[model samples]
Each structure stands twice: as structure tokens, then as C-alpha cells.
Target chain A: MIDSGIRLPWNRRLKLLIAYDGSSFSGWQRQKHDRTIQGEIEKCLSIMTNEDIFLHGAGRTDGGVHAEGMVAHFDCSSRIPDQNFMRGLNSMLPGAIRILDTNTCDPSFHARFSAIGKKYHYTVFTGKVHPPRIRLYSHHVTAPLNLATINSCLQAVVGTHDFSSFENSGSRDKSLTGGRGAVRTIYSARLLQQDKDCLVFEFIGDGFLKNMVRNLVGTILEAGRGKFDAEQFAAILAAKDRSSGGPTAPPQGLFLKQVFYQDRTLDHCISGKD
Target chain B: MIDSGIRLPWNRRLKLLIAYDGSSFSGWQRQKHDRTIQGEIEKCLSIMTNEDIFLHGAGRTDGGVHAEGMVAHFDCSSRIPDQNFMRGLNSMLPGAIRILDTNTCDPSFHARFSAIGKKYHYTVFTGKVHPPRIRLYSHHVTAPLNLATINSCLQAVVGTHDFSSFENSGSRDKSLTGGRGAVRTIYSARLLQQDKDCLVFEFIGDGFLKNMVRNLVGTILEAGRGKFDAEQFAAILAAKDRSSGGPTAPPQGLFLKQVFYQDRTLDHCISGKD
Candidate 1:
């Protein structure tokens, strides 16, 4: 067994509250040659602890999808203080990825398995000109969007549903899904903010399948564009077929805003929203 | 004269309201070979109009400084409607630089010579961790700043003063001084916003010397950090020597927020600030 020169246990589970700008990475998963958020963090942790450390993320985000509170866990015997890991990792990793917080947790706690829900934000710029500063964080559509139609469409996605119509086929492994398959519960779905030229959509769900949020956004956008009404959007959802959904929205506009473990209430997930 | 088939003036002055992410560009000014906001736009304008186009910026922002409403002007014989220039140039130009608005102005109206004043924003992140999403746009400082002291210090800079202490040497042409060397008017200087972990400083002035805003921000930040008091800040201004000023703040936090022409009222310069 590895020694930390102390009486404490050799391996302790540490959970990291993370954030990353997804523009520079291939994605969140580790690949052999590609740069990924997980791969970079794992390599940094391994170097810091002098052990091969594998990080378990709450979920995988596709390339160009940003995150503000992505959770991950890894075990190490380095004996370093929890705060030092945050500081060290932030200094070692590229500016695109940051360790927001770190803490030692019970061995039973798992970043992925223990996560009860996740919150995401998809921002769209409906203005004629997309400002350069926010171009990376928002999708631009010059066409005027119907906010009433978008809100009505969003209401249909709140309950538990088999979201196969919004899931991209072959993007997930069958075994890892743990028999849940396409069924997921969306606790809250609404537009958080609607400014003069921008819309911020917030979704808190039990879990998401691969590209589920983007697909939902794309389909909802079609309804907002008058391609369909609320009834048609619900019909598409009821179809439960992958081919029934609209195109997948681009990744840049999506952000994994937060992940919830024990607290799944709307008030807890959102700031000051009842 | 260039033929447009339908006859209009061969040399109509066109004004452009522009924005850019300055991290990827060398600076606003065009160099022989270096990538610049002006160079890229000029090249595209030349290609579109089939004539060598020269762009005149209201002012030059240093490398890594962003702009949301920078103004410029150029003369061309192209009969393309004003709207088409905005659309066509945006398509040809990189996403980092955008033309927000384009309009034909009188031949006597020069972007640089006719400019009245400019407004700039300096954003600082005081949180322990700078979010990756805003890392390119803000400066991070972990130390708590004295907002009261900062505001008091800002009050000293709200009138006409010789700001040579904040001007960098060799950055401006001596002949361009126009007989009022090192002196400029500051109509407004104050802290625009103070959120949980961020402070935004706004400066509106008749004109600014090279590196004036950044140097002033650095010196004011020094006062905010208790390096000096308001009286001492005024004394630094009175010194009129560049050596008396504090360090020059980084360029990333600076933004050319807007440029004023003909209108100089505070109500017009800021949105709902009056």
C-alpha cells in the first residue's frame, strides 16, 4: 500500500467542483490522443499525487459545451489539504478549466452514481447582430422567435418521459445507462430570462441522455420559429422515436450550470426562483 | 471615376460602429503584416469594393483590449446599399471583429478628427476564482478592495487635468498633440457597478492619451488597495510625471464601450445613468 507517512487511510475519496470553457477541449471524456477536460484533470491529479488517478465526472459534455459547476471525484493518497488541490490544479491546468472547489467525502459518494439531477442553461441571441464578447457563449438567430410558443413548448417537457426522440442514437453505452434507457424526469423547464435580444433557457432534470438537451432546444426552437405549435411539439415528444426530433442544437450555447446530489427542489437548483 | 453603372458620388464617407475581441488581434491599428482589427476590415472592404480601402479608427486600443462600440470611417465608391456593407463585411470578416452599424456620413465628417469623446469600461473580478467564461474579458484580483476609497479616488479625476502622469512615453506622436499636449477633460469617472465579486469602472473623457485609461485604473486601484488616499491621488495627478503613477493595468480588462460625436451629455453617454 502507498504511504502518506500518517496513520490515516491510504486512499480517500475527493470530490471536485469544477468548471470549464469547452471551446478548447475535444469534450469531457478522456481519449487516447485528444485533449479533454477529464484527461487534463486526471493527468494533473496523477502528477500531483504521484499515482495514476482516474476522474469520474457527473456527466460528459460534448465539445464546445461550457460548464459552471461540473462535479467529479478521484481517490488519492497524497496527504495534501483539500484546498491545496484546488489551488494546485488551477495553477497546473490550462485557464480553460478550473477547479472551483474540492473536498474529501465519504467513500460511498460517487460523482456520477450519486448525482440526482443536473441543471443546464442554453442561451440564444435573437438579435440581428451577435455581440463579439458573448458570441462564444450564445447561439445567434436573426429570425424573430415567438417567446409565447417557446414557453408553451417548454411546459410540455416537465414531466417524466421516455426521451428517445431527443436522444442521439449510439452516443451512449447501453450498459452504463443502468436499465433506465430513455426514460428521464425533467423537474423544471422554463425560460429563465428574456431580454430584448436574448433568451436564457433553464432545465433541471434527473438525468440527460447524450445530446438530449441540445435536441430538445432545437426542437423547441422550431416551434418558436412557427414550424409547429405546442400540440405538434408534444406530438413529437410522444412519438418517442429518434427520427421525430429536430436537428441537434450547436454545443457552444449549452452550459452545464450545476449538478444536484441530494437537493432536487426548484428553489435549490435556481437562484431566488420559486 | 469608378463605375457603379448607376451614378453616385465616387467618394462618400462611410462611418462604421465596430466591436472586437482583442485577445487574438495585435491591436486596433493596422501593421504591415500583423493581424489587426483594422487590417482585416480594410482588406475585406478593399476586396468587396475593388479599391484600396483605408479605415480610420476613432482611437487605437492596445493589444488584448476589447471594444463594444468603437467607431471608424472610410471612403469608398461602391454603390452597395448601406445595409449590404454591414451584412457583406460581417460575412467576410472573422467572428472576433464585427461591424455593428454602417452609415454614409458627410465628406467633412472624419472619424478621428471629428470625434468629441469616448467611454471605456474596466472590469475586475475580485473573486478567489475567476470563471473560465469571463477570463478573457476581466482582470482577477483576490485581495479585497476598498470601494469607498476607490470611489473617493475616482472623484478626484472628474474634471479637466493634465494627465501626463498616466501617459506612456513614445506611444503617441508629438505633432498629433495639437498644441494641448497631455491635457484632457474627464466628464465622468465612477464605479458603474459592484456585484458580489466584480467591480466595473467607467470613464468618459473628451480625449485620452496613449495608455491613459489603463494607467489611471492602475493608480486608482492602488488607492483602493490603500496605497494612497484621495488627496494623494490628486497629488499624483498634479505631479504630471509618468513615474509618479502606478503600474499599467492589463489590456484585457479594458473596453472601448462607446464613442461620442456631436452629443456630449452624460445622459447620452450612458444608458439610463442620468
Candidate 2:
């Protein structure tokens, strides 16, 4: 029965922990004319397993947005060991993308649907001169920033709120939102000062809308630069309109840090944070 | 006197502190067709000053080798402020390359001729899984490395000695060596363990030959992997032949950390160490 290569009862579902530089990729989703994370991985998988593979990512990140910890899943009938998958994929995929860990999961597990939360990190360099080494990974801002005001804005982002003001146009899906209309729960939001010149904003939420993190960062930066205060930030949140917010931040500084599942404990390890 | 634009007594020599990613550049030297650090800066300088510009670097770094405190100098007749040159060059140059600081210097000072010593760093990753974010900046090796053995090799490297075993062929310049041949003084050599898996080798010396740092690092790594011991490493040095040494390490892991001058104080600050 196994030699026939038909759909067998021993088919397994595999989960992958991923990280990518994102500078060389068009985006996370596969496209006909562009190099993307999904397309590259799927092609390698098909070659290895000799079966057409479809990869489902937790979420799609925009072009040039990096990821330190991402989650994805695929089904394969090949009897290859779990560790070989990581080695095989890394050898074939570009150095910019890597499969950090792989394991077999329950058949019912879904990369997108079963996710309980996600974590993101957006880095901003407030130095006088942006260092060349981190140019591809950070956003540079020379202007003075008031951290107190930015913290206040971050405080307002906690709890359940309608984040329509931060969401961009044309990516909302009624099925994905479950008719919540741009409403989501924010578990935690805070700022980490890695150094005098590096500001890292960490956000862990139930889910995020398209371009939501970048929009929040842009608007919060305006608050930090003394364009407005916590009151205005609250007002913008209450407005629930995209036009009420500031411009979207550039993509290079953003990173999809991790995805949280219901069964896994939150790991504070700072892997791939560079 | 300033209006004529001829070579006047007021023509000042300007020193520039530069940092570049180096992954995009061919090398530090100017080439007719290839993009290089010197070529890019000279082009921008010529346009800014409306005169042909020649940049003299403290030393030439090979392609794919990064730098943080690389120094260079050029003679300019334009009376642009030192700060403006920094800003103007940074604005025109690619983000991978940056002019960190600029200032006027004595007319007699030469970038390469006046260097008293130099510092270099080589990074190696011995982790089971090399992280994707630093793949371009660090060399990855999975074999277990013995730090004690490597440190012994490093200790053996200090003091004046002939380094022919660690120098590659075809870059010897008799005028620059001053008839010293491969003889050079290593002021200090040490290994810094940044983390459990990252090993950084720091070398300070009066001068280094072509491929010397990379060659030393490659030989030291072989020692760390138990391919040889300290006595054998000493024998390799005593052999005074390139064929007796280990292979040259790749360029991506190497960084020209700083160039010392006779009068300048040694700043222990870890600027551009990343």
C-alpha cells in the first residue's frame, strides 16, 4: 500500500519555525513573476518530496519586512525525518531565508486558523548618523523623540479596540475578521530601549490588520516628535478612520518576531532579533 | 586668492572616517568599471567640488570585507565646511556606505603613510543552526571549536615575526614594506566570545600583509577544531611559507575595525564593532 504512492493513512502534517531577511524577497505570498518566501519554500518542498506542496503562513508580510520568528505548516506524504527537512530546505533555499525548526503536528493544526497570537518588533534608529551595517534592517531618524509621549501612546494601544484608523485600505476580509469590523485584542504593547540610539517597539496581539503595525509606528513617531499628545492619539484611535492616522512607516524596520500558539509557552529568547 | 580656483596655499587636506557594508562593493580600491568604496566617494567628491578628486585610503580592504573606522584623505580646493562634506557625501552615497565624520588635516599627512597601527576583527559562528539575520556578516561553522586551543594560538601570534606563512601571493610592494619583507609586529591578539556560539578574534598590529588577517583566522579555526595544537601552529608560523598554513578564511567575516595614528589616543569605544 505504501509503495503505490497514493494518499496514505500515514500522511503527516509538519510545522516550521521560519526566519527571513526579506530584503531579496518580493513578499511572503507566492507570485507568478516574483521571488517570495512561500514560492521558494514550496518549490523546494516539491523537489524533495516529489509531490506538489502548498505552504500556509500565519500571515503575509509586505515586501522588505523581515521576520525573526514566523510559523507555517504543510502536509507531506514522504517518510523523511523531521530534522532532514530543515537541513534539506536550508541547503536549497537562499541564505536570506532559513527553516529554524521543524516538527510534526496534529492533523487538525492549521498555521493561520490555529494561531492564538502574534508578536512583532519595529526598530527605529534615532542616532545622529545611521550606521551602515544595520541600514538594511532599521529605520533612521535624526530628529529628537520624546519617549514619554510615545509610551503614553503605546499605553492607549492595549486592550480590545477598533484599529480601523491604523489599517490600510483593501485588505480586510469579512471571513477573517468574523464580522468584528477592524476590532482586535492587544495583549501587550511596549517599547524597549536597546541603547541610547535604538528604540524597539514590541507588540503582541491577537491579530493585526494589513499595514496596521507600520501605521501605528508612524503615528506614534509623530507623537514622539511633539506633533501631538496622548489625547490626540486617543482621538485618532476613536476616530476609526485610516485617514485620521499618519503615514505608514517604511518596511525595512518592521519584523514579524513570533507567533504564539495555545499550547506553547511564551519564550522570551531573543532569537534572530538582529 | 580663493577666486582663481588654482592650487593655492589654502588648499586643505581633509580626512574622512568611513564605514561601509562592503557586500555591494568590489573592494576599497577604485576600478575603472567596478563599483568600489574609493570610486564611489571620488565620484561624489568630484561632483561636489567640480574638480577631479583622488581619495587615499589608510589601507585597501578586499571585496566583501566590512569596515567601521576605515580612514581616507583627499586634497580639496573648495571651502566646504567639514560637517557639510560629511552630510553631502552621505546624502549622495549609497546607504551601504557612509561618511561617519570629516575634518581638515595637515597638508603633510598621508592616509596610508602615517598609520601607526591597525585593528581587525573576524567573526565565526559555531552554532548548529546559523541565524539568517547575520548570515552575510559572519562565517558559519558547525564543527565544535576548542577555545583554549585557539587562545593558545592567538597568544603565540603577538610580537614581531615573519608572517609569510599567513600572507597570500602577488600583493607585495617593496616601498610600503620598507625592506621588512613579511616581518611585522603584532601588538595584541585576543579572542572574544560574544555568546555561546559566536567567537570574535581581534588582532592589533603595526601592519598586515595581503590576506593576513583572513589567513590567520583560518589557521586559528583549524586549531580550534583540533586539526592542530599550539606547537604545530608555531611550526606553521616558523615554516614561513603560505603552503604550510591553512586555507584563507572567507572575506565576509572580516572587518577593518580601526587604523591608529601616532598622535591620536586609542579610544576603547566599540564603535562599528558590529
Candidate 3:
């Protein structure tokens, strides 16, 4: 039975933590005529449990990006098992999609609206060439990357800013189509080594605009590769121009690290902060 | 350069510790007719380095049997830098095969004949049902397994004996065809668990006869499933008849764990005294 005390006939809300390899997906959101992660998940759920599920994810990732701690929410009929909910969903999803954890949360807790923080990581592989085994998980950089130069530029992006300089221009304007706001806050950012030849750029924030993290990664990489100095990063901030950012990094290297909320107990994650 | 220590102008020997998914591979050894891991590696090397090669392996794993630390040796004309050996080999191999470690071992080191100890692991997920994500790596035993009774039966396979009973009756008998002696020593055999649902049966030995480990795993599994009495394993060994043996386990749940040597620095492994 679900967590509702008056079990057996009413709708019960549940939170699910998910992970997926996004190579074959268009994005997280569903479209009328496209292959998306949300579309596949909902289709599978409709077949397995015989319910029309409207799954809401914390963020929308582009094609070929990955997710290790994506947060989603859906409601189901009263027949769902509380302890084995994750087990049942995992049995129906494809190998690339996995439900890491699940729990019952307050009905008011929405995955997209209630999320307090989100984290993302961008992977970069070093060396003069690439390895085929790791090519799927990292972006290969032929030029030498200095960590100190990139770290200096990341320091400027660590606080609240308009962030209009680091995102797709059309998406940023589209988000404010209904006379809304466009400012957001960044908490922390750092880089890590995932393997011998691969490095990761990680960012944690209250929220992000479209393509903001990828744009920031490409900017820092330009500084690391000696194409620009930290002064250029500062100049880009002053200009508030999307074209000031470097080339967009590939989608294969980006990962949704985590999503945070107060009510969901299944928010604990292994890859990033919750 | 070879074990002879003479500078050979046309050849360079390379030794690699390899890992693979094995789900889409034919086997480790190359056949004149079939597409196998070794065959593909040779083909890719020929294309990349523009040289012919003869691939050698530590053991012949069956189709769908994975390898985490399988040792292999090959000779080619391209004199790759010692530092770039792993990266270069991995660039040519398929996504499923990865060269974990690479070294320039002596020509005298035949991966198969000149071996000391080898370890193999078989994973069993015991419960009423198992999660589909972990299903490829483990065997599902729907029936209850008695650990204590199964442990007792493992003792019967610890010493040197005529393993004719464990051999697959349908297999090509290398023992009858002037092969190495079938009597080999089992150094260690026990069940290991890294997680709750994942139970691993590890066997360390000098060498294994064709289908010996799978048959051994099947017999012990029968005891674990309570299908055969605990004492029946000893009777099965004494019968020295293939008909008395249990069923051969599926290759999907098996992995070549490691090939051990007396010293990691040496180019060759010490042969087993037994």
C-alpha cells in the first residue's frame, strides 16, 4: 500500500531518484513527435502498471548528456507497494535508465518546483589522443589544460549573478516570455579527476538557465587552453553577451549530478551533493 | 625485441591485461570462420598499425563469458611508445574491449602455457526474483539456497584428482589428444560477497580443464538449492563419469577474475609446482 493512511482508493504521491545514459535520448521533456527520456518512462509506466503517468524531472538535459541523480515525481493508484516500488519500476525500464531510489513524500512536494539545488558535471579527457573505451564518457582535449587558470575563472562565477553571459540567447529570453525574471544563484564549482586521463568540471547551484553550465565549462576551457586569460572571463561578465563564451562543449560529457529538496528522503546520492 | 634480448628490427611484443563486456562477443580465441574478440583485435590492429599480428590469450572463455583481468600477448611491427601502448591499443579495439594495463613482456611468456594461478568468479543472485539491471552479471536462483550445506560440498573439489566427471561429455577432449595433464591443484575455492544480493563463487587454481569450473559451479549450486544431498558431491566426484555430473552453468554469469604471477615486475609467470 502507499504511504497514505486512508489506503485503498485515493491518489498517492511518490518521489523517485533516477539515473540514465542519455546517448539515445532527445532530452528529459516529452514532445509530440520525438524520442525523449520522459516520453519513454511514461510509456513504460503506462504499459507495466496500467496508469497514465506524467513524470516531471528537475531539469531538461540536452541530447547525449547523462544523469546520475535526476529527481522525478509521479502519482499512482493505491495499489503500489511502498517498499518495492523502486524494484517494480526498474524491472520495466531499459538498461540505460535506472531508478536509484524511491520514497513517499508530501503531496505538495513537486520535483520541479520544490527543488532547492541542482548540480552538474562536465567530463574532459586529457592526453594527445583518445581511448575508444572512454570516448563515450568524456570529451577529448588535444591541447594541454592548466588547472590553475581555469580555477581562477571559476571563482568569479561562485555567487549570485544575472548569468545572462553564459547561456543560449534564445532560451534565456524564452524563459521570461510571460513577464518573468531571469536571475539565478550559483553556490560552488570545482573540477575532479574521474580516471587516469579524464577530468570533470562540476557545478552546484540553486538553479540554472538553459545551457548555462555547458557555456561556463567552455569558457573555463578556453582559459585553460591558453586561448584567453581570466581577464577575458571578467570582460565576458561585463559584456553580458552570449557570444563571448567559447565553443559549446559536447553533450556526451555532461551529467546531471543531483537535485535537492527538503521533503524527499530518496534524495541522497553517490555521485554528488543532495 | 623479444625474450631473447636481441633487437629484432621487425617485431615488438606487447602484453595487455584486458577487460570486456562479452555480451556481444563470440569468444576470446580467434577462429578462421567466426568473429571473435581476438579476431577483431587482430583485424583492428592490422588496420591501425598496418601490420599483421598473432593474438594469444591466457584462457579460452566461452561466448558471453566476461573478463575483468584476462592476460593476453601479441606481436606487431609497429614500435609504439611504452607510455602510449594502452591508449593506442584501446583506440583500435571496440567499445566492449578495454586494455586495462599494458607492458612489454618477454617473447618467452606464452599467456596460456606459462601460467601459475588463475582465478574465476561466478555470481549468483539468490532470491524469489532479481532486479533486471543486475541480471546480466548474476544467475537467478528462485529456490532457497542453504549456504552451510553448499560450503560442505565445496571441500570435495579442493585437491588433485581425475576431473573426468566434471568434463563436458560433448566437448573436444584435450586430455585424450596429448594435452597437458588434466590433474591440477585448486589453491582456494570459496564464496565471496561484496554486497547483499551479489554472491560470488571464486576459484583459484593452476589451470582448468574445459568446462571444469562451470560444472563445479553447477554441482555446488545443486547442493545450495537443496536438490542434491550434501554428501552427493563426493559421490559425483568418485563416479568419474560425466553422466553423474550436474548441469553446466551459463557462461553469462562467469568472469575471468585474474591471472596471478609470483612477482608483478617479471615478464613471465612461474609455472605451478603441482
Whole-model alpha-carbon lDDT for candidate 2:
0.90
lDDT of 1: 0.90
Residue lDDT tens for model 1, B75-127: 98888888999999999999889999999889998888888888899999999
Give candidate 1's error at residue A135 in angstroms.
Answer: 0.5
lDDT of each: 0.90, 0.90, 0.76
DockQ of each: 0.80, 0.78, 0.15
The number of clashing residue pairs in each candidate reads 0, 0, 1
Instruction: List the candidate numbers ranked by TM-score, top first.
Output: 1, 2, 3
lDDT of 3 by residue, B1-274 (tens): 3485545445667787888767677878788887688888778767766777778888888888888888988887776665576777677777678777877777777777676778888988875445433455667776778888777877777777778788876665465434544577776677777577777887887777788888998888888888887688888888888889998888878988788765452213222222
What lDDT tens digits, residue by residue, belong to model 1 across residues A103-133?
Answer: 9998899999899889999999988888899
The per-residue C-alpha lDDT of model 2 at residue A66 equals: 95
DockQ, prediction 2: 0.78
Best by DockQ: 1
DockQ of 3: 0.15
lDDT per residue (tens digit) for residues A26-79 in model 3: 878898898888888888767756878888888788888888889888887746
* Model 2 chain B: lowest-lDDT 10 consecutive positions: B265-274
Which candidate order results from sorting by DockQ in descending order?
A: 1, 2, 3
- Cα displacement (angstroms), candidate 3, residue B54, comes to 3.6
